[model samples]
Target: MHIVIIGVGGVGGYFGGKISNSNQKVTLIARGKHLEAIQKKGLQVKSINGDFITHPFLATDRIDIVEKADLVLICTKSWQVPEAAELVKPILKEDTIVIPLQNGADNAEKVSTVLGVKHVLGGLCRIYSKIEAPGVISHFGHQPDVVFGELDKSKTNRLQKVKEVFDQAGFNNSISGDIEVDIWSKFMFITTVSGLGALTRVTIGEMYENKGTRHVLEQTATEIYKVGIAKGVSLPEDIVDRIMTFIGKQPYESTASMQRDIMEGRPSELDNFNGFIVKEGIKAEVLTPVNTFIHSCLQPMEAKARI
Candidate 1:
């Protein structure tokens, strides 16, 4: 399959590198110094699992150079989705599956509005990764899983084809029957974790070690889960227990990419994560005090980064 990965940051770089290493025709859409680094030295992934490099894949800043791909993985920060969708339009064909591997439940809807509903796929990635340098991506854990499916919950040949590509690349993947529910479940986990970590300036390990902070984290998760339920999403009753268990097994120093972005003075996906919860909570008539508080607290940091 001809694949184009838009925004070759942590998520894009890691996955794209893996696919490229497996001999897939992958084109990376990147810009600035990172683009230069990839062009000169190839893409590098420094992971705990192992480090590898892919030097032969195409890398370009121009969307016009990107062919009509079988799959387009939109991996930009949440704020860049609309503009990225506009940029990707000319390079898309009718059957091209555009997977929005971004945080927040609104990405698929937003991309569908621009790229047409049939062409968009809802996806979430689980990985602790970052662009450690201009041409380098650092993956700290073993959580490299990609979950995606059709927006309408139908099993199609295209879905299976995409899964085949991922499987060939030796990556973990799953096709969900209810993509919206999957997106919400991931959003619930990410927003709560990012908000709490950013607010406290602590890693997942530090938060888990402190009973007070852990309580706050649980309360935050409950608030977000309630908002999801109020919006008519039937999240599992044991979601808190599941999330806690999952988090406990993670390395204590593990942090969300959003928290890392905030700490690095880079723009975050706050609007999509906590900000989305606040917007949806208002519409669903759900009181999300914890979400609201964290969203407000992070607003200044995001604003300052822009200036």
Candidate 2:
């Protein structure tokens, strides 16, 4: 099966590089210095497990160069989804499935609205990774797990075929019967961690170590969970406990991708993360003080980065 990965940053670079290493038909869409580096020196991934490089892999800046891929993984930031969708529309056939491995809940829906719902798949990715430098990706912690399914929770041959390819590529993948719940679960955790971490300027470990800060973190998670429940997403009852436990076990210095972006003065997914919650909360009449505060703190920073 042919696969095209749009926005070859952390999530796309790691997964695409893995598929390329397995000698699969994979093409990566990237731009700027990173694209130039991959075109010249190939894509490299540095992980705690091991490091591998894939030279001479298919890398291009033009989406038209890759057409009719069996699966197209949209790994760009949430804000970039519309532009990416418009650019890749012509490359999609009737059977082409576009999996959005992006944060926030609205990306898949937004992209699908533009490109047609039948052609879009809702997907979520779990990994601590980033483009450490040009041509290089760093996996800081956690195994890479990708979950996806049809928006309406129906199974199809296309999803199965995509699953088979991912299985062949040796990835932790799942076809969720209810991808909406899965996406919300991930959003709950991410918004809590990223909001608190970016606001505090500390890693997960440091944030959880302090009693007061840990309480604030839990409050943040509770607020997000409340918002999710109000929005009719079936979150697990013990999700807060589970998240706290996960936080205790995670790497102390680990930070959210959003937090990292904020620290580096890069455009962040704040609107998709905490800001998303705030918008939903207003609609649902759910008060989200913690998220509101985080959003307020980062708005100025994000504005500066855009300039």
Candidate 3:
């Protein structure tokens, strides 16, 4: 099968690199120094499972030439999903399967708005990684996992086909029984930590260890949980507690990708994370004080970064 990976950041790079090792053909769409480096040399992945280098059949910024993609992974930030779908639209075959593995609960919906529901799938990835250099990706923690399925939560031939490719690539993957819940579970955790991390400008450990910030953290998660429940996501009542415990177990130095992006003054998923929850809260008639505060605080930075 021919696979295309858009936005070869940490998630796309690590997964694409591993998948490229198999017999299937892989093409990576990237831009700037990263694309140049990948074309000049190859993608170097430093992973906890193992380190390896992979040369995709083609590595370029042009998606037009990557025709007949059997599968496409949109790994861009949540806000960029629509743009990605629009750009890759012409290259998609009727049977092409596209998965948005970016953070955010509505990524699949965003893609469907552009490419239609039939072409999109609900997807999310679990990994801690980043670009260490122009063409180098560092997977510092977590066994990478990709959870995906049809948007309506039904099993189909196409789902199994995608699973076979993931299996062949040798990374952990799951065809989610409840894809929406899976996406929301990840959404709640990432937004809670990322918003707090960016707001306080501290590591996860520092944020949680401080009494005042810890209270805000708990409030943030609780607000997000309330919003999720109001929005009718299948979140368990104990989700906030479990998420807090999960955050507590993270390494002191651990930080979220969104947090890193905001700290480095790059455009991030601010609108898609806390901002998304705030918007949904209003629509659901739910009160989200903590999330509103985080979104309001980051607006200045987010606006400046986008410029």
**Over 4 Å off, model 3:** none
- Candidate 1, 274: how far from true, in Å? 1.1
Candidate 2 ranges beyond 4 A from true positions? none
lDDT of 3: 0.90
Off by over 4 Å in 1: none
lDDT of 1 at 114: 92
Instruction: Please provide TM-scores, in order, for all candidate models, with all chains considered together.
Output: 0.97, 0.96, 0.97
lDDT of each: 0.88, 0.87, 0.90
Error of 1 at 126 (Å): 0.5
Q: Candidate 2, residues 28-101: lDDT per residue as tens digits?
A: 99999999999999999997768999863479988776757778889999888988888778788778889889
* Model 1's TM-score against the true structure: 0.97
Q: Comparing 2 and 3 by lDDT, which wins?
A: 3
Candidates ranked, most accurate by TM-score first: 3, 1, 2
**Best of the candidates, lDDT:** 3
The alpha-carbon RMSD values of the candidates against the true structure, listed in the order shown, are 1.2, 1.3, 1.1
